[model samples]
Target chain A: MWLYFLKRLGLAVAVVAIVIAALFAMIHAIPGDPARVALGPRASEELVAAFRERIGLDQPILVQMGNFYVSLLRGDLGRDAVSGEPVLRILLSQLPDTLYLVLGSILVAVVPGVFLGTLAARHRGSLIDRVTSVISVSVMSIPAFVIAIYLLLIFSIELQWFPAIGAGEGVLDRLHRLVLPSLALGLAWIGYVARILRASILEEMNEPHVRTARAFGLSENRIMYDYVLRIAILPTITVLGIGVGHMLSGAVFAEIVFARPGIGKLVFDAIISRNYPVVTGAVLLTTIFFVLVNLLADLVIAWLDPRVRHDLAG
Target chain B: MTRNTALSIRDLSISYDTPEGRLRAIREVSFDVARGGITGLVGESGCGKSTLMSAILGLLDGAAIVESGEIWLGETDLLTLSRGEMRRLLGDRIGAVFQDPMRSLNPVLTIGRQMTDIQFRHRLSRRTKRERAIEMLHKVRIPDPAARLDRYPHELSGGMRQRVAIAMALMAEPDLLVADEPTTALDATLEMRTIELLRELQQEIGCAIVFITHHLGVVSELCDDTVIMYAGEVVEAGPTRALFEAPRHPYTDLLFACDPARIRERSRHLPTIPGTVPGLIDVPPGCVFAERCPERFAPCGRLHPRPLRVRGSEAVRCHLHDPEVTS
Candidate 1:
């Protein structure tokens, strides 16, 4: 198991490196000069050239990429083009807001998804199962943006239950303002998690060990929650882990919709002005986060299923 | 229902409502398990041996309908009990071991945890439960029972898993143990050892066991009374030695004829009863084995024969044994 962890850690590093390279190439692929964009379009050629040399953009692309990699390793994410501040410091300020939003949304998705999915699977083929299935499918079918718009209309615009604008001040203020956005962001994924959980648990219910449990006189609740849930929840954890990237991306739109201060908003602002350093740092961090989430998922799966340890060893 | 019997099954009928038609899985089955003795229920595949066991356990599939039956354990009819009542009875008053040990255990849980979970309803202390678990594993002859407790099911071999299954079932010291082809998946040597272990456990625990299997040799070695089933009906039932010595039903005689151990000389090909057992959808009105019975006579095809008491405790369901209205 420790060996499996080491191998996965190495693989994650490789994935992050490849993603950083891709992000670098993709940023350059856009038909715009960051120095020109930072200066006005009407700026003189000499002025633009001096600006390029000042930012080290006058060097060859490979040399620029090597410089970016070395500086990234040294914890210097470079200065923002528009703001002229250290990108890492700016991201650090934005970090907690994004973490609160993303983590809140995931909690919203997982808790209800688990309960509804288990209920659906328990009363499978009954009215509850049919109703839950229909609800999950309908929710999943709708796009996240559409759901976000609808939630904004109902809770913020029509009902006036929450403020329709930017993230509010203190801890409680942020939590209160986050409610609608998180729900909007979370509903689709809640449906997905429920669907996966329902299928996984239904499969577990048919396993021969469940029959043995029944014969052993274990209560239905004990069988479902303790025995079946323990085995079935592994796949759900995998889905949640893989979902970290999706949740981060979803938070971009959510932040835009709610006008919140987070990394998503920072990335959105950076992309418009072609702030190369900020955009690169944001994408790089997202990739590293994604790779780390997937690695954690793999480790969790190995821990849950012992046969996986044997397979890894062999 | 019968007096002083550990399990008394009377006129039990079960059918599956499939899309094609209603398949009669078991029909008019009756039997009794005497206290502290093993009763072997022997038949070929699809002869409703498993269906009967499921009926006894009250664990039939969703599509199955128990048309009529009374499964009496002591004075209480098991069929009349509520689902909760039946659940309480299991692993306490009754225990069961299934055919495939490979799939019978929860692969994710350690053996010790599984055993503890099985006994959780009894409200025993954690320490006491662990002691009982180790003791039961020792009873099943598992080596290093204490260390083996912490291991998962996948870590154990098929035979070892089966021993753990037996130990788990017997933890509550049930009065009746239902073993449904428990040794079928085991190799020959393991099969012998498993049956021997069951016999020893039965003797020590003094529990009535309904041992279901296809191996006649096992029945001869372990059972005091034997019931031969055909197409879900008990065709012949009596003391094991008496039925083997003088089988009243022709199906019983044919079954004995196919027993390789009873043959004095080895043959190139083992004898088999010709023709497949009729499909459950269209079970014949007369004797179930009439089509396959070599000694089948007149009146064997048109009219159904009820079980007729022949001699001692022996009963046969055939026209030859029916003394009334002789043809």
Candidate 2:
């Protein structure tokens, strides 16, 4: 099992490597020179050239990437062009706010989502099932930003239940401030999770093993939770990895609407000011987060399902 | 009901609501599973063998409707019990080993966990349950039974998996053990071994078995009594040897003839019964087997023959054998 875990972790590290390369390539491939943008259009050619040489923009893209990799190994993500502050330092400070939002959203999405899915699956054709179905569809149809703005208008501005701007200080305050943003970001995936899980449970209900479980004279509740859900939840774990991506993108909308200080807001500001190092650092961190969570999800799946453990071990 | 009667199905008619209209899956079928006897329920595919098995277990599909029936386990009718009561009785009173061993046990669970989990009604301690699981596994002749408990279903070979499934089913030592073609998926040699294992286990446990299969060779050797079902009806049912020697119903006779083992001549093609099974959606207003029956005589196409007593403890459902029978 440990060997299998190491193999999966190795695969995840490789994926993160590819993602870093892609991120670097895409940013560099964009129109306009980074050197000119950093130095400003009014800077003389001599000064711009000197600046470019200083940042190693004068070298080939491969050399620049190689230099970046070496710097990454040294725990340096370079410095912000304007503020002259370390990019990794900036990201680390700003990351916790976003982590709170992401983790909280996942909690909001999964707990109720699984409960609703199990309920709907149990009462398959009932009024409650139909209601949840319609609601889930509507939630999926609406954009995360729109939901964020509406939540801001209702909860933050009108009701004054939560602070409308900036991530709050301390754990309790931060959690309180993040609740709305987390809900907005997580609402769409709740629908995805519930619908997929419900379908999965419904399908698993007919599997031969489930029938055998029933014939074992297990109570419906026991059979469902122990046998059926154990099988049904595998696919949902995979979707959760992809849902992290959705929430990351949705974080942009959520942080902006709620006016919270997070990696999303930090990246947005860095992008606007052309703070390339901070942007690269934040993107790299985000990619790592995505890869790490997926790897964790895979490990959890392996632990839950022995068949997968054998397949991976092989 | 006799105390020896482990399970008794009486005048059970089951139908399914299909797009093509109500498909009559089973029609007025009846049988008894005597305690300590292995009863073979053999029939073609879609001939209501599975339907009857499901009904006996009280785990019928949502689409199926029980038009009329009573599945009596001792004095209590299984059909009359509520879901909770049935749930309580299933693993304790009416244990089942399904057709496919590979699909019978929960794949994610260890063999021990699945075995012990079925003993919910016993209220035993955790260690006691685990001990019982290992003991049952030993009874099924699984090697190193204590070590096998930690392994999942996929870890075992097909034969071993079937043994695990059987061991799990009988963990509670249920009064009736339903083996639904338990050895069909095995090779001939493995099938024989499984049959032997089942017979020995049944003798030790003294539980009635409703073993469903199409393999006549296996049934003849394993079952104490045999039931031949055709088109959702019992065409012939009696002592295993008696039916094999002299089948009273024409359907049973034809079915016996189709057995490849009975082929005496050196022929290119193996024996196969001509004509397909009748569609259950629109059953003919006559005998269910009339269209394909070799003895399709006068009134055969228009009259549905009622089940009649024939030889000692044997019953037949065909117009040809009827001395005085009614629809």
Candidate 3:
């Protein structure tokens, strides 16, 4: 098991490295002048050159990448080109909001999604199953932004239940603002989770163990929850890992719609302003977060299913 | 003979709604199992033996519909009970051992947890449940029951897991134990051990056991009475020894001839029944087995023969076995 974990960690490190390099190259490749954007369009060529030198962009791409890696190793992410503040500090401050959004969204998706999915599976061919199936399919078909806009219009504009365009007053207020956006993003996610869980549970229900449990005279509820759900939920762990990655991306649109000051909004601002440091920092942080979330999911899956760990260990 | 019947099925017919339409899986299958007797229901795959067992336990999923039947356990008709009532009766009064032990046991949970959950559901106290689980584990002959209690299903071997499942079923000392191909998945030695263990457990508990399997050898070894099913019908039933010695139904004879031991004893070319069991959707009008029966007569394809008692307690459904006919 230790060997397998080490092997997976090694693979994860390699993947993160590749992702970082690609992101760096892609950011550089975009047709824009970060120096001009930093110093303003009216600045002379000399002023732009000075700003480029100050931000270390005057160096060759390879040298800049080398310095980025070196500084990363030393826990420094350099200063933002526009604000001239430490990129690491900005990221550290914003990281919690993003974490809160991801965690909250996942909780919102998983609980109701699993319950509804199991219900659909148990009451298969019933009206409830059909309705849930249709709803899930419809929710999954629509993009996150569309759902976010629809939620914003209904919950914020018409219903007036939540604040329209900003994070609310206190911690509770922030959580309240987070509720609508999280639900918006998680609506589609819940659909995906429900569908996956429903399929898995249906498949599991047919397994010999399920029949055995039923034969044991276990209540339908007990059998469904204990035997059926336990086995069925294994694959959902993998889906959840991928879902975190998806949720992070979805949070970008959600952050824009809700005007929440999360990493997604920061990245969006960095992209619009062409702030290389901020963009790179935000992208790299999000990538790392995605990788970490996936790694955690892998570990969770291994914990739930010994077969996976045994296979990995072997 | 005075012993109470553990399970009594009368005119039990089960059907299911398929894409094609409603398809009957079992038709008018009736049998009674006396307390403490190991009654075996044997047939080829898709012959509704498993379906019959599922119907009896009220475990049939959404697709299956019990068309007409009275599954009586003691005085109560199990078929008439609500889901809540059935749930309460299950595990406490009737236990089931399934075919695949690995699938039957929860992979994520420990043996102790699985056993204790059943005990707890039956309202046995936690401490007593633990002790009873360990005791049951010991009874099933699992080595180092204490250490094994912590182990998950995957950690144990197939045979050991099967024993654990058996132990769980026996925990409540249910009045009726339904074993559906319990030994089919085990090796030769494990199979023998399981059969022996089951026999010992049955003797101790004195519960009526309904053993469902396709293997005649298993039935001969473990069952007191035998019911041979063919295409959703009971074609033959009698005491195990009597049925094995003189199988009246052509299907039963074919089943015995197909047995490895029986085939080995017959120096001539081994006999095999041609064709598969008919699909439930398009069952032929007359006898379901007429297409496959080698000794099928002209009337065999035109007349459906109901089960008729021949001699003693033996019953056969073939025209040849009819008392009015002389072969």
Most lDDT-accurate candidate:
1
Question: What lDDT score is found at residue A189 in candidate 2?
Answer: 81
Model 3, A63-172: lDDT tens per residue?
99889889988988889888899998998888888788888899988988898898898788899999999988888889888888888899888999988677666798
Which parts of model 3 have CA positions greater than 4 angstroms off?
A: B1-4, B264-270, B325-327
Give me the candidate number with maximum DockQ.
2
Q: Which CAPRI quality tier does the interface of model 1 achieve?
A: medium
Better of 1 and 2 by lDDT: 1
* Ranking according to lDDT, highest score first: 1, 2, 3
Q: Which ten-residue region of model 1 chain A has the weakest summed lDDT?
A: A305-314
What TM-score, to 2 decimals, does candidate 1 have?
0.96
Tens-digit lDDT string for candidate 2 (A131-200):
8898788888998888888888999889999887778878788778888988998988888889999999
Q: DockQ for every model, please.
A: 0.67, 0.82, 0.66
Colliding residue pairs in candidate 1: none
Q: How well does candidate 3 score on lDDT at residue B50?
A: 79
Q: In model 3 chain A, where is the ten-residue run with the lowest total lDDT?
A: A210-219
Stretches off by above 4 angstroms in model 2 are A1-10, A29-47, B324-327
CA lDDT scores, all candidates in order: 0.88, 0.87, 0.84
- Candidate 1 lDDT by residue in tens digits, A80-112: 877779999988898788888878888888998
